[model samples]
Target: MDILLNVVNYILGFGAAVFVPLIMFVLGLCVKMKPGDAFIAALTLGIAFTGMNTITSFMTGAIQPAAEGLADKTGLALTTVDTGWPAMSAIAWAWPFGVLCFPLLIVINIILLVTNKTNTLNVDLWNVWNLLFTAVLINYACEEAGMGTTVAMVLAFVGAGLMAALGIKIGDMWAPSIEKITGIPGVTVPHSMTFTAVLMFPFELILEKIPAIQNNNVDAKWLRDHFGIFGENSVMGLIIGIVLGAIAYGELQAALTLGIQAATAMVLFPMVSKLFMQALSPISDAVGDWMKAKFQDGRELYIGLDWPIVAGSNELWVLTILLIPVELIFAVVLAPIGNTVLPFAGIINTCCAVPALLLTGGNLIKMLILGIIATPVYLMVGSSFAGYCTRLAQTWSPDSLAGMGENPSITWSTMECPDFRWVLVNGLSGHVVAIVLLIVWLALFVLLYKHMAKRNVEIKKELGR
Candidate 1:
């Protein structure tokens, strides 16, 4: 197990910039593309990922100061530190048993695909960490309940498989919405990050039924046509950045600098997205062709990608920037009620924003409310599980919390496990409340799965798809 785990980690350790391209290169050749063409496609994907990572660094550079400024200005001192998903993912991989989940999920995905149970060939293999983390948490719960290691691991792996299937279903339902919203074809985000949309689905649908909300047809494009540059996406980003900077720094110079940075991001994100779309085409075409050949219905196959594919939408960034102060306030308010997460590291919160953008069809009002609704949940989950996460970090990967303190509680605030999965796993620990909540969450998902398909269709027609 150690040898196999080391090999997998060595490859994945190269990160998405390498791992995704390597997979795509192999997949491209498997689908019968010429070696030269496959190489170009793979390299292009590598470049696109590299560019996205660079932009992410720029975003973090801008936001980190803003986060610090917000913390300083607000004077809040929540105890648990939010390390964000990257650190948490590393912690998941460090779990001695987590390596088993890597291959297990790969096989599960293939089985699901071949059985016609899920349409997504989830090539977003790096996110297997999400499943691993889920299982690790479940394993902890089972151990606390006095289960043996063998029983705990079996239960953990079972829970992880179910969650993966749920995510695949979500991605399948979400495919059309991605196409309708971003105009990107043959791609879907089947990763756990997108599972956040489930929280907003019913609420967005409710808002759609309200007369006032439904009747209001005004949007950014309308404002752009009538009011010109002020409504433009880049200008909107600049305005948001300036406002955030002012709130965080309380200074003109810093505000303008951040404003320019945000505007630059708004302009560059879409340009980079164009590169990704271009590079993904050949590989996507091959996958689509392969799927058609296998299925007589000529159904198209969508590549399950990382959520960053939709991060280019100015709507996503718009809501994300606007929510920073609100999220800080949420953390501060919830501090008294066991919510100790400070909302610092994962302050960008695209995990919620990406899905909200797609589910709401870029409707800023709906997206804003959806984010507001999800914030407390993220905070509470972070708080509820911080100690376990920290303990796991200490046992398996102490370096993860090295700089925090002697024994600081660490939490991945943004990528909170979807409500049902969390509750269901906790139910295994024999908590009556958790068991009841698990049932409620399952019922909700059952209904949600029913409506989401139809809602996505409505969204597609709205986009003229």
Candidate 2:
């Protein structure tokens, strides 16, 4: 029965991805839009959903293996007694320190959202995942080749860290050059030093929890808060700090438990929230844009609530309080029946929050209603198509090594393999969806172009000598 339900839910999820876009098209047409306009909107929503899913899946694939290798080397068990997902060991070890750092992360994400700037710091989430994965792969290779764990960890850390640092720095420096070449002014890289430091918090926790490195007295929490240490502190000092902290903490098991929970919350909650936002974004944007056009008399109103603000808001607090019982009910009543269903509840919670935020905008009730109707339809179509494509790519190339064979040197395979696949899948999906939707959007753009051409012909006819 549980398996049947899960299969049903997965089917429903895929359906929702397809359904959401079709609904968006119908809503657009109801507003007297040309077929082209409606189609474009639907297509754009589809593309966005697909792109995000693809990137997310690719990152997950790359990171999970590395995380597993790191766990094995550190003597952490790989299986969760409950779900059996790779225990997110690094995150698990850092759980205790996370308590001190979680609030700060919320603040940083909120600031970024409110400022409306794309932060480079946000990219570090991906970078850390990638680097950690790379470290794991390298460590695995070392062990397979008969190197000691100590040597493997050291080499992996140094190699991955140097690569990460170089990639980040080069990307930052070249961003302006690319923008200039494209003639776009005022574009800056996202994620300040502060944001990057905060992003590294989970990784720091992982480092702290490793038993072998327990002698290093590293204050993971303190380093997370201090940019100078991360930026200029000597490598020896960092290692020493970790060794000392582990020794001071004493109970490796307890420290590991705390670290896992903290890192889990840090990664899982933010990711869940992002997924909610992605699911909600098209609807929110459509509704907000419609309301401003129909009701706002040239005054700008913030209709969408950014995720960070939502996480920090009093409303969220109240919602969390309300949800506690609901979560408990699911755990107690539902988990006995099946545990996988619980994660879906989290997804549902996020989905519910989107419509709530849209409705709360007050002045845009009609638009909100339209958005509520349209969101699910878009999500159903978009997510399914994206997930399918991403999974296909993963099946084709399960590892970076397979994707980039015969390259003994590192030679940018990290970026090259994943980047090429991501661009190809995302770009193709976006363009194809856009074209298909254009046909349904009332062909307003096409009609306008034809009308202009006719007018030019008439002018030529009138001016003939």
Kindly report the root-mean-square deviation of model 1 from the true structure over all alpha carbons: 1.9
lDDT of 2 at 100: 20
Q: What are the lDDT figures for the candidates, one per model?
A: 0.80, 0.33
Weakest 10 consecutive residues of candidate 2 by summed lDDT: 408-417
lDDT of 2 by residue, 53-137 (tens): 4433442332233233323333432110121112222222222221222233334445644563322222222113334433444
* Candidate 1 lDDT, 1-465, residue by residue in tens: 989988988988789888988888998998888889889988988888888778877887798789878888778887888888778888878888888877787888889888888888788888788888888888888888898888888989888888888877778878887876567678888877666666676787788898776666345565577769987878987888898899888999999999999888878887787777777888888888887787898777778888777766777877888888888888888888888888878898887888788777777778888899988888888788887798889999987777787658888777655565568578876689998987777676667777778887777687775
lDDT for position 87 in model 1? 82
- Per-model TM-score versus the true fold: 0.95, 0.25
Off by over 4 Å in 1: 217-220, 458-465
Which candidate has the top score in TM-score?
Answer: 1
